[model samples]
Target: MKKIPVLFILVLLLAFWGCSQKEKKVSVKKVGPIDPQMVQDQDDMTWEDYKPIPEISWADPSIKPKRGFKMALVAVDFPDQPFVITQPKGSDLFGNPQIDPIKREDVAQFYRDFFIKPSDVNHGQTINGYWMEQSRGEFGITEVDAYGPYQLPKNLWEYGLNEWGQNDFTPDGSKPKGRMERDVDSLWRAEYGDLRKNYDAILRIYASYDETGVWQEFGEMKFNSKEDIPPEWGNPNPDKPRWVATRYVPWTSWKAGAMQWGISSIRQGENSGTITHELGHYAFRIGDNNNNPYVEPYRRAGSGPWDMMDRGCFNGPGGPHKRWVVPAIAGASMPAGLMVRNRMKNDFLTEDDILRLSRDSLAVTGLAVANITARAVEPFEGEYAGVIVELDGEEPHDRTPVDDPAENPLSPGIPNYDYYSLEVVQRIGYDSYCPDNGVLLAKNRDKESRNGGVNQFNCFNWVIDAHPEDINMVDYDKPNGEKVMRTIADYRQLNDALFHAGLNSGSEFEYDDPYNRLHFYIIDLHRNQEGILSYTIGVKSLDGSGAAKRDFQLTAPKTTKESVALFTLKNKDKKAGLDASCFDNDIYRLAVSTEGEGLKAEILNELAVVSSGEEISIPVYFSEEDGEKSDVRITLTAVSESDPSKKMEASYVIP
Candidate 1:
């Protein structure tokens, strides 16, 4: 049976049969850009010049064998190279370096073949190509049309966070067309990396998208004429060709594409990965995991370097080349976001390898998988918790975060800039629901918080979706500009907690006060005096100070007896007890998950749980994390069947 492709990914988002949200508590930690050496550079120099571009062999095929996807990327003149090279020597190599008069015709022929060979429409697989065609994963010619804002010039090869002032490009004007910035940090170069040469150009962005929603880039090919680029583009100090791929792709839209499809001799030098990368996407909706914020078809891995999904990022592979691969959806396959946990435990894997491989694998998982995700967070501690809570009927587990699917849709068109959360996750610590690397492939988007509230545990990122298994609650902070009772939370223990606390019998339980009066236990009040847990008793209430009243409200303190001292309000106010007049005159105690943080209910126009509730219900909400996945310190701020605020907070480790 054949499964038809859906209309669009976002469309499915709106109509998901059962949507749930899993969140990660990620702290926003800033990181500088990666150095130029960290980025991969692909040069398909022609044999006429150095050795002609080498052919990448993917012909062996797996499973379906010949029936599998077939693609080839033929660079017109081997411009941008994804490999390491020494600075250019003073060969002063010059000669109207191979210019095709009918470049337009050549380009046209290239596409003709690209569409004709396997018939482009999904040879027998998905229609409209990969994401199925975002990065397409074909080693074909590419340009700004597909790369959109992420395109880099064959002449301007380096990548990282980019966005340079025009001045950075050729302050000297030696290369009038344009110049690549050399002094910028690795990040700036990637985000705003600009064009280097003046000739026609084509850049192939290798991409991979797993079941999660992250697009990973593993390779790229930028082609242009060195001659077209001014001397400045090459760098006055000159280190290997700044743009190894400046072969023949001009800034113009010509026919050089014909050679890219393996038809023209002038195009023999094209980077095969360039074409192959696009095909990879078409075949799998896989993105480039390059980890270079500026480049596209970016592929990222959380661990293991044996698959094409593990191509770019920390898994540099020494030089440019995305040669290995694993079945993205094998029965025993791990979620791409968390492939690293296994790698890290294996003797063959090193910390450095884990860093690179995991990032790459996660990036792939983040891009492709609709259910899981991984974050490449900076190393942090305690701030993160790994726990699974039941949601939509799922059971709880001890695993950490899956990738944040809400923010990571992995399809093309969405810029890598939106990926800041990945950086934030990488900064804290890496974990995975599936353990592809240490990251999780997440689902369940937290969409309601955007309207605004004092939600401390809710996620701030509007884009990412969390997992359904981790029950992270909605949170908000107090508004009254005051701190009541100090509280402590135990978010990490959610998975192990049974959350079985509730009323023992019915409404009438015997109780005696110091007055020796046997009174019926009508209402349950919390320690801090924030709220009252009234029983569903016939309307009857009499108020008095201290232990005299059962339905109204009162004051108290101390709600913890944990082996480890739980919490103390750094700022405590003796005057912070509950104001009974604020709670609903009628109602029973509220039951919530152990992951429950805080609560507040108001009467007519008056509000007892205003911004800062009476010390009774200690503040329940906090700040939402800006990034996707993270730890949520949810404080149980409510009137339990047995207690009230008294600063009773239970931490919930959420998305």
Candidate 2:
């Protein structure tokens, strides 16, 4: 072989090394705001198609008020359990009686204003305010009058120590005293004869703790076990154990476990009670959306902390565990706002406020896309407060598999659901204490009673959990040093159920139910200048593609950072070609792969929503934890959400 110059060989090696070391310049295009007008209008679709899901009517129409109404507030005190307001500061286990003793009239006025008027004590939150805001001023308490702090005939324990096992521990070992309503009502009638008929609703505020608030706090939470409960916390009968059987859990402190949890039938409440939740029962005739959260045969919560009817009533500064605090300033203080289902059930939402679609019609129309404003506020003109996709065509609309909750608490339960409701929940207004903000999607039954069967759990609204895996949160530490994990039935389990748009957003953007033949997508999120959240959502039948074409073009990838590459995916559908009457946006599912040893790649967002002529920038990150860094190739794949067959791929080499 002819001899080659050593210098020439050296130069060749140097040039090759330089070429391998060269950096690729990446240009990131700024994605603009999605135009609200781009979303298709379903004007051609009428409400008649929504016949499958009929309008919700109150069980008792007489109580459904559409205008301002009068409310009466009556205060009562027990000989044994004086009003917490009359006790010294820090008198109870929860450091209750946060204030010094006050006159009975002052206490009555405090509660009256707390329920009817906005005051600094209630943080400007009131039952009337909640109703007015929830009803959009369609209804509220026009007038509120406070009555006497009439003393009850029986001792507080007579009424409080009745439920659970307290009956066996009564002073004489007889059934705990009953007829709290009859006693209080008689007292009120004698003092203000027939005045009860003047008010639209009557609220009886009693002194002492609401069992729901103190049950766990003074029971299992304070003691290691039933056997460990001390005499001080026991019933009046010293021979009887202090612990007693209670709902959901096996045992709790007798003092609290058996106390009557604020009742709504008689509109009775306590100092540390969720009056809003009770009002939901008394005023709207809505049943509890909560599920059994403490015992075996674990079942998931219904709406969880996202709806006031559920454990969302326990929303506040300290979560459910801190509900024992008095002055009602901690947990259960600020309840979550009503969800779309409850709002509709209570006649709060208008006909035009919701975009209704029939599941059967979706198969013919392809897909429906619209923007929904947050449930906390009124929607803008041409916008909807929510989207309802009714399961229309078949005899069995919900095709979800019947799974045993006892085996897996996360099971979807009996599948006799009637429709799906999609709404946005933002941490604003009454929802300020809600855990998160995103798309709230749920499978709902038209009739609340239909939620019972295999699981025997009653739930009318079943929220779809985006992250179903156990969150592994510790509820509280037992006195014996054991860690009690929050059960699958715990309402907080749904804390991460809301779906958010884009990849790596810690939530899924879309939910696909092949059995139900539906695909729901949270395409993009937007916040107006007022800090209100809204989402551009799309729904399509898995059986067919919508009227809009699903096509996109992915640009060549470029690296802005050593291990980061950016790609712009643009919708190929021509805006001019779209039918003005019914157009649909396109959703793209992205995937990233790496071709090199010890190299790993990830895409910032696994999904993107691109409208006609619109584009989105996707970021891919590369990492090499081991082995020497070398040239690596990254492939980016984009698949159309509406039409999986339509796909595109691009690649970039990082040195």
Candidate 3:
């Protein structure tokens, strides 16, 4: 009797299990960008055909010539104290000299060899690849001495601290940051002003100071204590981490004067990569590609290891921090290269270099393919013109920055904005620092706006990111499981997150415009043996009228049924002519199959002509004589006549 009850209990448990299986998550087709005009209907769905555009007549302004661009290398120091090249040994309280006190010519020779000499490792490419390519070998950079060691009018921190009140040194007070530029200029004029016109730009280099000396100088200033010094001044180690002054970017309209360039002061015997970064600003009129390190959520990445304009300048064998060691080949390790957007802006690439296609055009054409090369290397004629797939639509405009603390505010112009951009990113050349290899799609507003609180020219350029929540991808300082506040360590993580296309075939990226007039899709991604990345993309237009299109989607079954499996088919087209009998060349063929015995497949509408507002049902039945214990598997495929490879599928199991 107990065994009979146990058997009944087992049957009851099995019945409950069968019912629970019906609630499983339905599998939907993952497709790239979807058109907004298409909607799910009872029996059918409308889909648009997407293909690459042949070409776009890009009209970027021609790059200004930088030929004969001479830069003066001035070795300046404080009064009476001669500049000494001090190399630090591990944990040493004081720095030890690597060589005898060097003169201005030594510094000049160091830069000449660093920039002009071809690197054996990087295919004989010179460190000055960015400038050389833009100048086409016509540019000349001259290095000169600023005579004797130029003396500062006051202590290094004093000139700048005086600009801020005692309270301003506090955490919440305004951090008068740019005042150092004034001190740099004042010292320059007192010493090198007479020789100013001798070069197109002036680079002032300084030696690193010991931590004790730095803290002492800060203490002497009216500022409270060492606490008031910029966090960049904090010694990395108590002993001798070496006191490399922060790299000040080049500014044309600096308080000191125009055409003034400054580099991050390095360890006495070390060289500099900051020069190349500053040059990007001075020579090209381009803004810094890096995020403001002093801002909040400190790990946010700016461009992440991709473009010369971003963190790629820090690319090398180890990383940016590793360059601090002496006998270092690390400083100029992976000298960065330009990205497509920067290339286009600099006029380094012409319209002939890019292929521009419209969403409407792709819908008319069936399918297209592109064999693209890495953007870092020179293009091979037409491997891929910077891919510009356009979704013809518009959305309401609101340009207010999310965080801007400026006193005077600017209006975000444009009642409505049209047009956007997409580009590919691969790990090649300087871009070896990039985190992944895939398509980098972004929203590029056709208008320009200053990055509000950041006060940068390139603020308008925004990259859509796939992982905004992950801070480790682009940040240097880690939070280490502590409450995040607006401390220097926390704020500097502000970065511009960029969205990438799906990493593989099973994944897809779909983006609909804010106004719902268009769709952008990253159909597929592939990487070749040469380490080049190629992206397949589709853009769909949602405007009222263009061409009639059909999209197919299978609504996967949730649970097991007795012997019959049922599926829903939807048509999303808006054309008026779509109806049940429209199948001549635009018919959808349904194919059904099953894995288990006794399960017979039957399609109610094998070659159904699904209209825009129609819906169809498909059922696969199993014979009762096959037995109740058999588990059946079923699949339904919908193929369109427009494109044979373009299909959608749904699967289910019957127990």
lDDT of each: 0.21, 0.72, 0.41
* Candidate 3: stretches off by over 4 Å: 1-68, 80-105, 118-127, 132-198, 209-272, 289-305, 310-336, 357-371, 389-419, 445-447, 451-458, 472-510, 514-516, 525-529, 544-655
Error of 3 at 357 (Å): 4.3
Q: What is the lDDT of candidate 1?
A: 0.21
Which lDDT value does model 2 have at 186? 89
Q: Model 1, range 460-508, lDDT digits (tens) per residue? A: 1211212112223311122333322211121211111111011232111
Clashing pairs in 2: 366-546, 367-546, 503-606
Worst 10 contiguous positions by lDDT, candidate 2: 35-44
Alpha-carbon shift of residue 170 in model 2 (angstroms): 0.9
Any idea how many clashes model 1 has?
216
> What value does the lDDT take at residue 30 in candidate 2?
22
TM-score of predicted model 2? 0.83
Q: Model 1 — which ten-residue stretch has the worst lDDT? A: 210-219
TM-score of each: 0.22, 0.83, 0.54
Per-residue lDDT tens digits for candidate 3, residues 49-158, read 11111131011113223454565554444442234443223322223233334454465444344444544322233334445443333333433333334454533333
